[model samples]
Target chain A: MKKVYINSIGSISAQKTFENASFLETIADYNDTVLPAIDPVYKDYIPPAAARRMAKGIKMGVVASKIALAEANLENVDAVITGTGMGCVVDSEKFVSAIIDNNEEYLTPTSFIQSTHNTVGGQIALGLGCNGYNFTYVHASISFESALLDAKMQLETEEAENILVGGVDELGAHTVKIHRLINHIKPEAVTSKTVLNSKTSGAVFSEGANFFVLSNLRAAQTYAELLDVKMFNTLEIRTLSKAVLTFLQVNGLFISDVDLIILGNNGDVAYDTYYHELTDKVFAETPQATYKQLSGEFHTASSFGLWMASKIMKSQSVPEAAQLNTIQTSEVNTILLYNQYRGENHSLTLLRHVEV
Target chain B: MSELREELKEKIIEQLNLEDVAVADIADDDSLFGDGLGLDSIDALELIVMLDKDYGIKLSDPKEGRKIFESIGVMADYIAEHRTK
Candidate 1:
């Protein structure tokens, strides 16, 4: 089997991730229950003509993918795989609202066309004129993990040399209102310093697009070698520990072998117990880090977790802001990323240091 | 005729998110698609909806929009003649 490496990464998140020169150095202070990503100037990466029709999700996806491809120094890739849980939800809301308000008489196809979950992948393919394999996964929180897994399989089997894979989601006002009504979002704003300690029942909703180029051929831009990625639609809280153990054991890793563990603790008092079980028990001694507080909570927030892992490996330094524990490592190498959404769609992604 | 043409330009700019373009930027006879204003098929769909919603002129077949939406002047003329609202 061929080794797959994260050759390049481009992220537009709640923080200033798109610049590549900084990684959560100066954080964006958000005290709102619903946070929005710090958007990049779309015109820099996308032409105005093409960007005019793109909604937030598409714009973010296109720009992030372009950044990834550019960093990898490639104009095109063999495949484009995207995972979006809510799809172009902003467009979806627009289309649905238009249909209702206009009584289905005057309805534009732009929003409807852009509303599809695969629109990002499709648009990327269109922008690059890549007619090769293109697929989009829409599995709730594991959506991004699904895309990464597919890319990994193809790279491992040598089915494709390089692949552009991404997880993108845009905020929808209607969706946020509904999730808020159901208490899926925090009732009040919680600062990053207080998000974990907020003891809230729901997370701070947010959106982002994180894209990476995965190739069997490692490059200087390679962040780390993606060892394995696994997703579970449903895993009992009790068996979660064993699942992580088995995942690491299969990869020839142990609890101590992991230099760092990046977690997806979104500050939901209810579901966070799942992570607390691992961090408070099994991996208690390991250096733990949290990111959902920084990126805010979205379906594919795990991709943000992966992004954090990749950055830490590349720089060999974990941002002081993201660490959940003060126990720092001398040399950062192996990383285990664990993320779950509202006690479901659990994903474990293992990445290791690649000696270039 | 000129008033409607100007109004159409303003509306088109607003509806299509042509933030960089203004009402005066689009001449009366400028092509709205493919090289002039550089609109695409999707923009045509949006304009079709705008016609039905704002002017009550429904063009069920989007392909038929090619003639009416050839330019701001053409669209204004068509809407001026057929507008029910």
Candidate 2:
């Protein structure tokens, strides 16, 4: 099997991460129950006529994918895979609301067409004229990992040389309101610095797009080698440690072999114990970092964690803002990311530094 | 007649999400589809909905839309003649 390498990354998160040169140097602190992704100049990446019909999710996904393709120095890829929890949700809401208001009369097709889950992948393919394999995974918390796994398998068997994979979700007004009613969103506003300390029952909901180009051939701009990815439908807290160890062992790694651990701690008091189960016992000595506090929690939020892991592996330093513990590392050669949502859809992704 | 033409221009711009366009940019005789205004099939569907909802004109034959929607003057004249509302 061929080894898969992460050649480049693009992210549009709550922070100003669209510019790849800087690594979380400036943080946008937010004190809100829900955080919206910071917007980029859409015209720069897309034409106005083409962008006119796009929702926020589509714009972010298209721009982020463009950034990744540019960094990989490719005009197009062999495949495009995308994952999203809610696809173009704003348009979905608009279309449904219009139906109710008009009594099922005089409906237009734009909203209905753009609201499909595969629209992002389709739009990216249309923009590049790439007619190769295109797929979208709607699995809840592990959506991004599922997309990554698909890309990894194709690259391993040499079925594809390069693939563009991404995860994206945009906040919708009606969706946010309903989640708040069900206590899935934080009841009170929490600032970035206070997310981990929020001690609340729910997480601060947010939206973002994180994309990466994976290839079998390493290049000068390669970020990290994607070692492995594993997902679980459900994992009990008691067996969490065993699962971690078994995952590492399968990859020919021990707990100590991990140089840094990037965890998905979204400050949901009820479920964060899953992460605590590992940090408290299995990997106490390992340097640790967390990203949901900065990116905010979404179904595909784990994609942001992978992006951070790739960045740390390339820079060999951890930003103080993302540090989960005071422990520092001399070299970040290998990193593991663990993420879950509402105590389910657990995923583990391992990345390693590429030897030039 | 002029009032109806202006309303049609505004409606087309708003309905199609022509964010970069202005009311003055559209001339009465300018083509709505190919080279003049640069709209495509989707915009034709939106305009069909607009004609039904706003002017109470239901187009039974889609081929007729090609001629009626050729320009702003054509659309306004068709709507003025067939509108029941």
Candidate 3:
């Protein structure tokens, strides 16, 4: 019934993107397998008392939501929807370890209380003092897309005017060890500039939180209009291109209509072929870009992709740090973002430039 | 008994993750819940677990926690009287 626009964006990534004024002007290149999100002064956004018990995931999520809300110039929203693949993994690890270390005798309540998947959403609502609809999706890589879809439905149906949606995941020591054992993380370090073409077997794992304020009511701060979003549990490499074309067509767009394509190519030789299906064939001529090099490969890292798309649309320039190809576009009106994790949970999101 | 009070303050600060607070900040009779130390119900549960784990003092009734955790002085007194370890 109504159109949805990305009114504001906030991101806490491996790169310095928390401040809205600059967009990748100075990229942080790292030669590491696990890129932790750059820290913001958490005390600046949250009081020391409230932040004392929070793990990094919760802090990042809370601060990112606050940035988005402030950018949107709203004190409260009707709903808060968050998508986190490993919800509060640090706290969960702490709670579980305590269970073992103390023989289940002296488990504290703080870690247990904060370990739930919806804790970020609950904390945000709690901080805002807003008793409203809050939901969290933990469907691996498509988690962010799921939250976006839910928020979009409510906004389009006029159920909510403004909604705060975000995706966050924090690195857990044990989880990273397990992933390393399974070869889910890269064997060796790769710099940010070289991660995409290293042709590695596994991704450079990372953690981040990216949030946005989505609203049906457009304002001067609107970044882009959310056109459509599609997700799949499993996609055959052969059918990936067809899915992209179909998604674009459904949104009344064609190959030429898409001004740029943002791909989640995490340099995993085993799975990056999913993005190659479109990049090499269907959308080969389209200006192409990738972000996993800069953001690393977390489940909801696609939220960072959405953040990049919004900034590109608003600023009308694609940062060279994230550019995957030499192709250039004079005007970036429509952007298609495709992302997946280890050949599963594929998501396609369409965003169009909003003239404000 | 004064030694117990100092130990209790250290433990409370460490257990509740009161990073900004020092041992001196928590006066012996200062309130631990509302405006004094600004702890809420969650911190109360942490204190309960701390008492059970370190002092071997298990509190069964939550209402009893209101009086017992009123301050570092009260918590140390309760633990000194009831602690089995």
TM-scores, in order shown? 0.97, 0.98, 0.96
In candidate 2, stretches whose alpha carbon ends up further than 4 angstroms from where it belongs are none
Score residue A234 of candidate 1 by CA lDDT. Answer: 95
Instruction: Give one digit per residue, the lDDT tens place, for model 2 in A126-157.
Output: 99999999999999999999999999999999
Which stretches of candidate 1 lie above 4 Å from their native place? B60-64
List TM-score (chain A only) for every prediction: 0.99, 0.99, 0.99
True contacts kept of each: 0.86, 0.86, 1.00
Candidate 1 lDDT tens digits, B1-85: 9988988888888889897998879999999999999998778878887898899998878778999999988888899899999
User: How would you encode candidate 1's per-residue C-alpha lDDT over A1-356 as one tens digit per residue?
Assistant: 99999999999999999987777889887888988888898998888888878898999999999989999999999999999889999989999998898787677888888888889999999999999999999999999999999999999999999999999998999999999999999998889778988987999999999999999999988999999999898999999999999999999999999999999998889999999999999999999999988999999988888888999999999988898998889988899999999889999999999988
After TM-score superposition, the amount by which residue A300's alpha carbon in candidate 1 deviates from its true location, in angstroms, is 0.5
Clashing pairs in 3: none
Candidate 2, B1-85: lDDT as tens digits: 9999999999989888898999999999999999999999999988999999999999998888999999999999999999999
Candidate 1, residue A324: Cα displacement in angstroms equals 0.4
Decreasing DockQ order of the candidates: 2, 3, 1
DockQ computed for model 3 against the true two-chain complex using alpha carbons: 0.85
Q: Tell me the tens digit of each residue's lDDT in model 3 across A20-62.
A: 9999999999999999999999999998988998999999999
